[model samples]
Target chain A: MSINLTILGCHSATPRANAFPTAQYLEINNRHFLIDCGEGTQRQMRKYKVGFTKINHIFISHLHGDHFYGLIGLLSTYGILSREKELHIFGPKGIKEVTLLQLKISQSHAKYPLIFHELTSKESELIFEDDKVTVRTIPLKHRVYTNGYLFTEKEKPKKLHIDNINHYEEIDRADYNNIKAGKDIVLSTGEIVPNSELTLPPKKPLSYAFCSDTCYKPDIIPIIKNADLLYHEATFLADKTDLAKKTKHATTKEAALIAKEATVNKLIIGHYSGRYKDITLFKDEAQEIFKNTKLAEPGKVFKII
Target chain B: MSINLTILGCHSATPRANAFPTAQYLEINNRHFLIDCGEGTQRQMRKYKVGFTKINHIFISHLHGDHFYGLIGLLSTYGILSREKELHIFGPKGIKEVTLLQLKISQSHAKYPLIFHELTSKESELIFEDDKVTVRTIPLKHRVYTNGYLFTEKEKPKKLHIDNINHYEEIDRADYNNIKAGKDIVLSTGEIVPNSELTLPPKKPLSYAFCSDTCYKPDIIPIIKNADLLYHEATFLADKTDLAKKTKHATTKEAALIAKEATVNKLIIGHYSGRYKDITLFKDEAQEIFKNTKLAEPGKVFKII
Candidate 1:
């Protein structure tokens, strides 16, 4: 399985002419998800051509304006579009009340089923799961209650080795299912063909970790360990460590340190503060600790093959 | 005196990639006001270079997402910028509860005083008034309790007629204030000059009427009569008259009819439905009934001189 991520918007604080706040589209194992919808995120999704109908689940990191202000507008747009699919929202406990109040006051006709999974736990826990994928929350430390998310692809069944299966005429099409199920196939001549010899192991499952709007917390490292891809918030550089600490946001070095400690395969840093004119400095600073660090830009895509 | 209006966003239903929802920046007699803040209006304000801090009053037409979803985000941004000025908001009754709930849930640190003038009156009534300008609600017919706004510049003091005053040697600079106040000039010889002869009347007060998401209602003609400029929602063309009626929206012909009957100097038709690919059709249809008609476009400026 593969994971594709599209950064719809990634900037800290208010949205400017060129700088957008935080939002991302993650497509893992054919399932589409939206993460941390800031203001103007719907427009950004339109600009980036994110499939609107495919987004059935939305994960909000926190209730901060920069993180979840776009949720209401997006839901209203969905209503205008006459979306019939049930939508699931995962966020803080107050998300349901705030969202429903707006929808009620606005008299929105979004009659579709909106299921809210309000999160109040301060520890990592599995929040979403389906046949193809599973999502877990990584509780994060921020000025407000927040949670990161981990998405993983479920293990697939073994694949039949065509060349090895053809070696014996007794290995008929009927026996292929048994070999693919990791079972030994017995031949009519009383010989046993091991499943490992007749079938190949399935491809390794991929996982993506999303952490944003949080202070430097090493406790989350173990939960996101060895993730194929990780997106961490880096709102400032090392020079502003004091400011970062005061604001409860992470610096580039802090994000890189977390990435390095977690041993994630690749790290993507975003949520750059508007005070910084050059975003490349964030990548440069993050790369000092993690060589595979990348800067998150609007419309930028990261793929794990 | 002049009235400057910038169309920030003027579309119907939902905000699209290129088409924005209803939002306008109106500057009348040096007073700045933001009218109908749709989602992404802050970004649009930055794009069009609308002075953010100058806007102390915001008027929302209705609780529709297209009308006022961006208000929360803009208020949050103002808090981030450390704005201390008290903001006045005028909208429907439930606006206060919905807006305050979102702010509270998000823990927005906007300590600035947000005064809400809830409008539940069915008849036209003045809502906001300052020294330079006055705003009134034009009760509209829509699916929801909606009210359009009428912004009128207060009449200025009379202008001194220098050429006419030059003819009289007794008209001294010390008496200029009386002349500007439309008082007759009294010379040292006790000879009285008529106020009309000593001073010229101030420029006629300019007014703008903003109507959106409404059906064809002729009763509003008296409320918007002889407006300097009128922006009326035209969500559909003549061919889709049934749809417009069903949706409680107005067609181009209906908007033009209102402008013509109201004797407005200029008419701006906007809130075009997404089905209409050629927005020029709206202008053409509107121009058929009203000659002084313009299509509302993002960043388009309309001036009443």
Candidate 2:
């Protein structure tokens, strides 16, 4: 299964006319998951036609307005629609306070259950485990308590060539099972059916990691290494290395360094500072270290195979 | 002078697709004032080109999410824009708690000073006084402590007919004022300049009263009666009057009763429930009782002449 990522917003602290705040929609095995929810995200979802009902989990990296300002609006809307299914939100400790306060002040009694899973540690650990994927936190170096999420799709079942194997075709259930298990099948009547002739391999599971608004630390290299798709924050250009260090933000070169050291299949760098009018500098800087580098633009979609 | 009102959003409980919650842009003279802030207001402002900088004063009708969900985003954007002018906000006591906390957590300090005028009473008292207008609170009937805003534009200065004045007129400033005030004028040259010939009567100031998410209360009629434009909450249709009363929200028919009894020049009914997909029923129901009823549709402007 391949993972498709859509960038809803890719701006830093300040929201610009061209670039919005940080938010992305990741679709794996036809299931939709939201990464971050910036302000005006509902409108973005509407514009993109991403069905909100399909989204079951939202992973928030931090408490910055640019990161999760649109969360309350979305939550209240879910209540207004009288949703019955539980909405799962995974974030830091203070997230529940902010979310609960908004709901309480609105006098909104939700018809659906709201489940919150708070991440407390700065280490690699599973925050969510589901039938299709597992989400783990990757410790990130930022000004405040923050963690990036790693979504890894579960292993799919073995494939069977139904078009070739039929009930009347002498291939029994045991023979089909042997073919599905990648073994040579010998029928009861001394007929042979090779595994390669009856079945193909199941698609490989895909994984995507989101690391933003953080300094490039080598410690996360092992955790995110060989990820199918890795998005890292490149808030500044190479010339502003000093400013990046002072602000604890990553420069393009540093983000590129992480992608290179981790050997990620695809590197997408974004969360650009508004000071740089031309974002091509970040693209140029990151491309120096990583060959498959792309600048994350708002509303752009990328596929990881 | 005429008062112009634009319905930016008009839904009560929460934001819905195409039916935004309580947010409106009111304009009198050269000023623009935001009455309420529903979610996605900045996007609505951008779509309508209602310059955010021109919004000097924001009057929040209540602390409900439908009324104030977009306040922090607007304020945050103002901070990012480095607005130097002071922003005067009028709202309930919890408003400061809502805004200040978000700013604190996000570490976003505004470059401009935010002056919050907390409304904490049920009396018809003067809340905001400016050069061109004076604002008073009309205590409303709602589940929470909600108050409606009465924006009354100051009376215009009478025009003086300079060409009609005598060349040898040696009238003092007080005499000119008296003449402008419709008093008889006697010139120094033994000539009489009648007030009728010297000046025209000042036009009456136009007023717009915003009755936020509240039920029909006849007591407020004395304060908002005969307003140039009156916006009342019509959260439900005539069929759901019981639900409306139970929720402390006004039905379309109920809102029209108040508008008709108050003898308002023009009535705009809004704060619609998301249940009704079409809003024409609300206008028809209100117009059945009040002839001059109008629906507050998004991006539509209603002028008070």
Candidate 3:
């Protein structure tokens, strides 16, 4: 199994000229999941070619305008496009109220089933599960009720090559089935075929944890530990740590600390303050503690191996 | 006095990628007035360089999201930018409730005074007047309670060439002021200066009528007649006349018909349907009926003559 992640936006509460607000796309086993849609997210999707129409599940982190302002517009566009499939959204308790009230006031109704799951942010639990993947909310600490998500791919079945099985000489049908089921086999015609000779081992299940928009919260370490790829909000540098605390945000050092403690394979930090013109300083600050840290720039993709 | 009109968004309820909903920038004298703020308007402003921070007055057409989705995000951004100047917003009865709910929900308390001017939208009356311009709402027909604004510039006084008068002969302050004020030119030396020789004719007061997101209503003709610039929505092609009537929208032909009936100096039609790949067809169609028709594309400015 293989999974890929795309960073849609990475700016903080304030919008900058180049950077957009918070949003990310995670593709696990061919299924696309959207996380923490911000203002202008649809435009970002179009610019990045994220294929929003195929996306069904959307996860919003919190109620901040930078987080959920684009949801209503996107929802309305989907309605105009006459989307018949049910659209699922997982967010805090107030998300439904906000969306419904806006829809009520505007006198516009959605043509699709807009299923909303308002999850409480106090606990970490599985929010969505399907045949291919499972998603769990990573409880976060912020001024508002916020939660992140972990998208983990399900284990792949033991590998089987139909051509290789057919090519095998004098192999019994039952023995071939056993070998395809990850068992060493001896044919009834006195022939033996090793499992590796017939089929290779299944690929590793990939897990992408989006600690999407949270301050420095140590409580989420247990849930997000050892994630193949982790994206966190580093809204400020260490020199402005005081400002981050005052605004209930995270500094680069704090974000790196979380990544280092959780043992995340790769740490992608973003949501930089617009005051700093050079974003490379953010990566430099984060790399001091977590050597695998990198800054999330727009139009760039990070691969998780 | 002159008023420069720019089309921010000209769509009706539907929003497309190239064509935004309903938003316009009316610059009368030196003040900027915003009418019908739609969703993604700030992004539109950024893309078109609308200079939103300089805007003081905002007039919303109705409670539709296309008319006012960008308000909350713009207001929040204004607060973050530390803008302390008071912002005046004019809209219908339900507008205050809608904006206040967004602020309260997001915990966005603007440091600036966000004054609300709730227009009854029941009749035509002067809603605002300044030293340079006067604003009146032209009641229109729509599915919801919607109104358009008539932004007319105040009359200008005669322009006196002080340098010409001083270079030609000695002129007293009293005489200069009198000539500039359109009074009989009298001098202390008993030599009356001909007003024609010293003063030039003042430019005509430029007027712009913003009529958007409204059906082709005959009631608006008298109110917007002979406006230097009139922006009417053309949400569909003439072939979709049935769909236009069913949805309470207007076709390009209908929009041109209204402009022709009102005898507006310049007619700009926009709010195109996404189904139409090219909007040049709209311009061609409208120009076939109304000679002075133009298309309202983003980043283009039209000077009121």
Candidate 4:
């Protein structure tokens, strides 16, 4: 199985004519999730061919307008589309109050159940888990209450060696599950076969970490260590470290340093300040510390191996 | 000297790839105003070349998400643009609370003063007035609190008759203001020139009425009588009259009937339902009852004489 991420928007502060604010769509093991819906996110989803119906879960990084302003509009559109499936929302506290107030004043009755999971913890905690993957909150240091998410795929069952299994007469279709589960095949002749002879180890589980709108906090490196892919916000260049520190946002050098310390396989940087017209400077600055650095361009997709 | 209206969006419900929700920019006697900022309205303004700085006043018809969801985004953009002039907003009572709460959560401190005028009157009342134009609210019948605005230009000064002024020795440059103000010119030689002889009558004051998301209410006809141009929402066709009534929206026939009864100079029907692929059917249905009917196409500008 593979995890794919599509960059929906990656600009900072305000949406400009050529740039959009922060939004991303992640598809992991056939499950779709929307992360940090900024203004015009629904339109961006439509423009990028991402179906809203597939987005059952939405994670807001913070309450900032550039992070979650499109949420209300997206919910309203779901009502218009007559969506009946329950929607799951995970964000900081006060999201429910803000959203419900707008819906109440508008007199819009949602046809679907809205489930809210407000995160208030300042520590790393497991937020969601299922058979395929597990999700946890990575508490981040920002001007507001913010939490980044870490997704890790569960270990899969060992693969069955078909040729080895066929060579044994006792091993048949009925024993396929046991062989895949790393169990030895029991023969009627009372001969023992080790599990290593019939099965191989499961492929290494993949992991991804998303961090945005936060300062350079080295504490998170341990939680996100060895991730296959890590998306970090690089709001400013190293020359503007003072402004970045004042705003509690990370600079390109800081993001790259975090990725290097975490030993992540790949690093993607985005959320560029509106002042910088050329985004190439961010990639250039980030590559100074990390070799496998990439820019999170809108509509670009990243495949996690 | 001229009133121009540019239709930014006209679709009724959720925004789609091919259709946008309600938004309009009206330039009346050199005053620019924005009516009903739906989602993505700022982008539409940019696409239509409507300067956001010129729009000092914004009038929201209702609290519906399709009507005012774009307000907060626009306000944030203004802060990013460093607007120092005070911006005025006129809407229902709860608008200020809703808008301010979002701004507070986003930590967006406006560089300009945001003046809010909460309208609660159920009768036609002048909400804004200046030397150029007067704005009055047209109470509408809807499921929620809604108000349509009526903009009327104030009476202008008479135009000077340059040839007539040059022929008379007493009517020099000093007497130009008195002649334009409809005052008779009195000379030192005791020769009296009537105001009508020295200047021509001022052009007739123009008026425009904007109504949307309201039911068929005959009570507003008198308030908008003989309007130079009227924009009324026709959300559905005559066949969907029952649906329109249930939803508190107007049908094409109902909108046309209102325009005919009010004796408006021109009628523009908009807010077309997404179910209807061909908008020509709405125009045809409206024109059957009102001869001077037009469709409010996005980006189309209407000039009022």
Whose DockQ is greatest here? 1
Off by over 4 Å in 4: A172-180, A185-190, B171-178, B185-192
DockQ of every predicted complex? 0.76, 0.30, 0.35, 0.61
Two-way TM-score contest, 1 vs 3, winner: 1
Given candidate 1, what's the lDDT at residue A285?
Answer: 93
* Per-candidate iRMSD: 1.1, 2.6, 2.3, 1.5
List of chain A TM-scores, every candidate: 0.97, 0.90, 0.89, 0.97
Model 2, C-alpha of B9: deviation from truth (Å) = 2.4
Residue range A44-113, candidate 3, lDDT tens digits? 7777887768899999988888888888878877886788999999998878877887777777788789
Enumerate residue pairs that collide in model 4.
none
On a 0 to 1 DockQ scale, where is model 3?
A: 0.35
- For candidate 4, give the lDDT of residue A166: 76
By TM-score: ranked, best first: 1, 4, 3, 2
Estimated TM-score per prediction? 0.97, 0.84, 0.87, 0.93
Q: Candidate 1: how many backbone clashes?
A: 0
Candidate 4 lDDT, B10-82, residue by residue in tens? 9876656667789999999999999999887887887898999999999999999889988999999899899
- Give lDDT: candidate 1, residue B179: 85
- Order of the predicted models by lDDT, top scorer first: 1, 4, 2, 3
The DockQ value obtained for model 4 is: 0.61
Model 4 earns a TM-score of 0.93
